[model samples]
Target chain A: MKTVSLAEMKTGQSGRVKKIYGGRGMVARLQALGLYPGKEVTKLSAFFQKGPVVVEIDRSRVAMGYGRASRIFVEVGE
Target chain B: MKMSPKPKRMVLAGNPNVGKSVLFSQLTGARVVISNYPGTTVEFTRGKLQAKGQAWEVLDAPGTYSLEPTCRAEEVAANLVNSADVVVNVIDATNLERNLYLTSQLLERGVPLVIVLNLIDEAAQKGVKLNVPRLQELLGVPVIPTVAISGRGLPELVAALPKAGRGRGEARSPDERWIWIGSVVKQVQRVTRRRRTWLEALELASIQPLTGIPIAALGLYLVFKVIIGCGQWLEGLLENYFFEPFYLPLLQSLSRFLGDGSFWHGLLIGNLPGGQIHLEESMGLLSTGIYAVFGIVLPYLVMFYLVLGFLEDCGYLPRLAVMSDRMMHRLGLHGFAVIPTLLGFGCNVPAVLAARNLESRRERLIVSAMLAVAVPCAAQMSMIIGLVGRRGGAYLGVIIAMLFLIWVAIGLFLDRVLPGYTPSMIVEIPPYRWPSLKAQAQKLGMRLQHFLTEALPFIFGGILLINLLHLVGVIDLLAGAFAPVFRSLLGLPKEAVSTLLVGFLRKDVAVAMLIPLGLTAKQFVVGATVLATYFPCAAAFAVLVKELGVKDMAFVAGIMLTVSTAAGTALNLLLDTVLPAPMLALFLLGLAVVLIAFCGGSSDRRESRKFTLTKERRV
Candidate 1:
């Protein structure tokens, strides 16, 4: 297993969330969207290198800005 | 004698993108727009439903991920849950696990609940199976599987409503709830792996930058072409067939009957400069006013709404937002601002109201002000196309490009000046679906009805007020007072001042007023651009005042006046003396770059610093 920020995950890579590094509000908002630690997520695509990232979590597609995506630490298997 | 019980309140609650709105419309027979995107219902819509011979007040609340509010729209949804005698918790069957989070929250609230497993057909197509009865037994709530769009399973849904009962209301922490939901899902749900569909491939193509950008460009080009080309064709057909042949003769006889020089004649038929009633110049209630609303504006309004409705329903808007996020971030806004901005082109009133989807007050104010100043509603846009489109395509392009520049400039300026952080975009992107023709027609019908009922009267009143002002010399006095400013800065004749004054009431009418003045093409460009930027029409103005509050609206008004004056003068001088079209285009591009570098630099730095701070804190 390898740990990396969600932004660093390649397209189509699936990961389990390890930790979310942000303020309480950001963390809670992500949590409400079912993006808590231990939840499985797949990076679907990103717009540009630094644009919003699209990910699949709990069978739904969510597009979030790059900065927020970077704060999510995920564990992916090699 | 028994008193009838008061109507029971039933609220539809769900995570974003469930078929709650479609279900609401089916139950109440109300024609609310059903879009395949989150935040479509920014405010709750109330409709009446008669079931079992009892009146029910049904509300479609804004969709939220949880009962605990994360944004304004969710706060609205959360509050409505308290008033609901029975809550219909709509769940997207394809996304059961995530949607069940909200369902669990509602269950914890202990409200009378009915679980609607919506989009069942879609889930079945994706090889998903559920044990409905087992699920019902586990949750202790009546569950109904429905395909709301097709109106299938609706009768069963209505029949099950009376069976609503409070679920297990045990409060659970977030982690605990997910764990419990997992167990329930494990027992009652099964998935069969299947090959990916073509629609899935297309959805993937739409989000990737390489194909998505080109697709976006082509899509926008098609939208404009349809709106402008079809709008003009319809306008010409109406003019050639209905207005010119029938309405003109009818009005001519009325002109004769009222006597040529009578006050009634002037008010209804307007002044005949050469014993001829020109529809564009007449300014009469029956002549220019009617033609402006129905003849010129209605065709374009219909086409704009039709196109906008399709975009909203097909689920392309969120992708557009995603594509534009990088550009939007430069203006301290996320891509979500694109939703309200696009709506502004239809009508600034709804667009201003739609700003509620933004997370912060500062973002709302910036977006609303920018919309007011830059985006031209369909009515005004059609008039501009009708008036200046005759000159050439290049002229129209310049005006559009100029407005785009102004929109960006305002966003960049406000991003720097406003003292608040813009919340980043975190939005769900629903898969593209074939828009229902019935739903599109219903949405178009609702918008047209609003235009006819609300805007038609405003247009007529504005014309009447202009005629009254002209009769009493108020217009002339105002014109004389602003003559030098108009002549020197805008290079417009003194008579054009009346149009600007009328603009505050109705911008399309103001643009139509320019037809009589016979200004040169350059003057027409300046006048139309100024009219669009100077103020929101009275209807939009009232909405902005409500949305932004009196103080911020005043600040917006001040910005509008200053920006319009500067833009008008710049257009006048640049087009007249300094540069030709190509050079002016280059100059505008340079100005944009300089503005971005100057105004956007600080905000970019601040954003990076904040991100780094969060990173360091994590370590």
Candidate 2:
């Protein structure tokens, strides 16, 4: 199945970033953060509307944008 | 210069943005060499001074928080503190509690410490009163209340400098320091429940993420308009007054007298068909390069530095960091990254170095890469203003809009791809005050001095190199080889191929080279924007390589090359499809959406992760 929103994924979920939707500045920003696909990610938190969401990928803790989380497609880890 | 017998040495250490520089200047009559710290490129200045008839060497280390060093500046500061005979711990008088933490760390190391209570006047004006003598007694160190900008208490500071020794300074550990600070504050500082004034309200408003970002945008816009407009006006004046009326005629007559066939004539008069220098139109070394440097780049750089120094001295930059923290969080970095971004505006060399303050290597690499690729320094921006803004105000708006979009895109991308813990933001909001004119002027002069001393030589060398290349026919050969790529990939003229070749040496000079071509407004915008984002100047590149290591620097260079070429090529295609007005409007709209989406997504993801962790804990 195709990956769905990060919000829908479980704690051990992983996914490849499919498409980045933004203009020149926006895409460049996303790319800089290492969001481009083919990388594995695991969710660490998901609670309040505006709280810290921790994700581990590339041996580093990455905090994602709220909208970015919603837009992201993740596949659950086996 | 020979020094007197047995010269004294003192190392200056403090939190970033403290008036350590101002204090150092007051103490040292000698010029301080200012640039970013090694490893991380934040600027530091070192100088020599004569105090009590004894010559002393003052090493001003970049701001560090504690002795247990995390960032590059901290490592350097710690090293200096360990080695120096005396450590002058300059503390911002307003943020005594936070500033004292570093002092505590210094005391722990058992260094000879002198606490310069800087910005005392501003603290008092803000209604924060401090009993300096009482505090000094408590800390078991000599505490000098200094209005460093005005040289107040400088004599006392000098007098007490020599008596420095390793003493059991009271605040040796973090807990002990805070406890002592609390007790001392109770005794010396009076806290009144004063209502917020309009200005305080304004200050608070400025730090609110929503309000602050817009304010930052507006501030940037105003700065660009003023600096760019001033540069153009001066350029016209210099052209008409100095070149057209005087230098052109003199050069022409000299060329004729020298009988054009000589090598000096070729070198001096260049390859003009008539072998005469028409200074107004001719791009001669003396006329063009000097005109470009003085008339164009210097004015803008000076003006930009003046405003930047004022903002820095006024203690607004830290507050700006606090305000931008929310947005920075979206990029997997802390608020302090804003410091690098601000420095990047002046020059990326120092900006990339300043990135060392970030908590993790990942954040540093991301910031360094972004700065190199996206941020255009004062010199490059000045040229952009000349080319783009000269067309009309609308074109100027589009270029800015494009830059904003690029910043947002890069930040968002980096946030997701790079793996690093985003440091929790803990910024001290320094008291707002009017910047001292003397201090501002000194800072401006220091920055300009570095630019002139370092960059000017390279600029001249670059010109000479280009001349040699052209004379030896290498330029023609290279231009031909690169012509297909230039036309298809970058949509620039083959002559522009040479400009690109020289761009790595000095961006301002490269852009100036394009002036002779008389490209249309759209072409100018595309070319300038791409160049601004393409590659950092040679100095900045060297700093990046040193700070980030050769492997990472190579990676960053690859990214910059690819992005700039692709963006420039894409822009050329898009320009043909859309009319100027609609294209600009669409671009701005797209940029806003991108920024919002990027910011919103990262924050939301962070929140969601936190939520699950809390839920797991409850379970």
Candidate 3:
């Protein structure tokens, strides 16, 4: 298992959320959208290198800004 | 004898982008605009529903992911659930696990609940099947599977409403709730591998930058072509077929009956210059006012709303939002800002209302201010075209380009100056669906109805007010007062002052007023561009004042006044000397470079500091 920020995850890579590095509000907001720790997520696409990232979580696609995406740590299998 | 019981308050709550709105419309038969993206319904809509002789007040609340509100729209949803006698928790069947999170929250609230599994057909197509009876047993609530768009399962839904009962009301922490949800899903849901659909491929293509950018360009081009081309065609048809042939003769006879010089005649038919009534130049309430509203504005409004409705329903708007995220970030906004900006093109009133979707006050203020100053609604755009398009297409192009530059400049300037950093966008991109013709038509109908009822009277009153001011000599007094600014700064004739004064009331009417001035091409471009930038029209002004509060509205007004004057003066100076085309291009490019460099450098430092501050707060 390798840990990386969500922003570093390659497209189509699936990962288990390890930790979220942000304020309590940010973590709660993500949790509400079903992006809590231990949940699985797949990087669907990134618009550009530094643009927002799109990820699929529980069969729904969510687009997160680059900064927010960078704060999410996920564990990926090699 | 018994007192009638108060109507039960039924609130529809759910995760964003589910079919709550569709279900609300079906249940109440109230046609509110339903779109494919989240935050489409920013405010709750109330409608009356009578089922089995029991009166119910049905409210379609703004969609939210949880009862713990994250933004303004979510706060509205959270507040609404409290008053709901029975809450219908709509869940997207295809996204059961994510949706159930909200359902669990609702369950914890212990409100009378009915679980609606919507989009069942789409889930089936994706090889997801639910044992609804088992799901109901596990959740301890009545569950109804529904296809909201098709109106299937609606009867059963209504029948099950009376059976709604509070589920297990045990309060659970976020982690505990997820564990419970997992157990429930494991028992009642099945997912089998299936072939990816073409729509899935298209969805992937639309978010990848290489294809998405080109697709975005083509999509926007088509939208504009449809709006402008079809709008003009309809306008011509209305004028040539209906207004010119039938309405003019009747008005002329009325002019004769009222005795051409009478007060009522002037008020209704306007001045007969050379014994002819000019629809565009006539300032009468009935002549120019009716022609402006129905003849010119209505056609364009219809087309704009139709295309906008299509974009909203087909789920292309969210994709557009995602594509524009990078560009928007430069302006201190996220992708969601595009929604209000696009709505501003149709009308600023709804645009101001739509700004509620943004998470911060600073973002809302910036959008509102920029919209007021730079964006011209369809009505004004049509009039501008009529006023300037005849000069040359290039002249109109210059005016549009100038507005775009101003829009960007205002965005950048506000981002740097505003106190807080823009909240990052965390939005869901719903899969593109085939837009329903019925829903599109309904949305179009609602917008047209709003326009006719709200705007038609304002136009007539403005014309009457203008005519009254002209008769009372107030117009000449105001014109004399502002004449120096028009003559010196704008290079417009003294008579053009009246149009600017009328501009505050209605932009289209003000541009139409420019018709009789017969200004030079340069003056025409300056006048049209200045009119668009000067201020929001009366209808839009009212909405802005309500949305932005008094102080921010004043600030926005100040920006409008300053920007319009600067734009007018710059255009006049540039156009008067007729600089070479390449020189003009170079000058504009230089200005853009300077503006970007000045704003970008400081903002980048401020943004990093903000991130660190947030991190400290978290610790």
The candidate maximizing lDDT is 1
Span of 10 residues, lowest total lDDT, candidate 3 chain A? A44-53
> Tens digits of per-residue lDDT for model 2 on B1-619?
5556886778888876576766776777654432212122244567888765678888778776566665566678778887787889988786675566677667667788888998788677666788888888777788889887788888888888876646564444334555655566678776444566787666655654457568878886887677666667777787789767876778778778766567666555554644445442245566566666776777778778877777665666765565555566666666568778878989998788678767568788878887888888888887777656667877766666666666666767777666544545333444456666665666688789888898777767767777788889999998999889888876778877777767889888788777766687777777877877788888998899998999988887887887787777766776635657346747765865667554534533664576566447644
TM values, all candidates: 0.97, 0.80, 0.96
lDDT of 3: 0.86
Where does model 2 sit among the CAPRI classes?
incorrect
Which prediction has more favorable TM-score, 1 or 2?
Answer: 1
Native-referenced TM-scores of chain A, all candidate models: 0.95, 0.68, 0.96
Please report, as a value between 0 and 1, the fraction of native contacts recovered by candidate 1.
Answer: 0.67
Candidate 3 chain A TM-score vs. reference chain A: 0.96
- DockQ-wise, the better of 2 and 3 is 3
What Cα-based lDDT does every candidate model obtain?
0.88, 0.68, 0.86
Instruction: By TM-score, rank the candidates, best first.
Output: 1, 3, 2
**Clashes by residue pair, model 3:** none
Candidate 3's TM-score reads: 0.96
State the lDDT of candidate 3 residue by residue for A1-78, as single tens digits. Answer: 999989999999999999998777778889988898999999988866478899999788899888889889999998
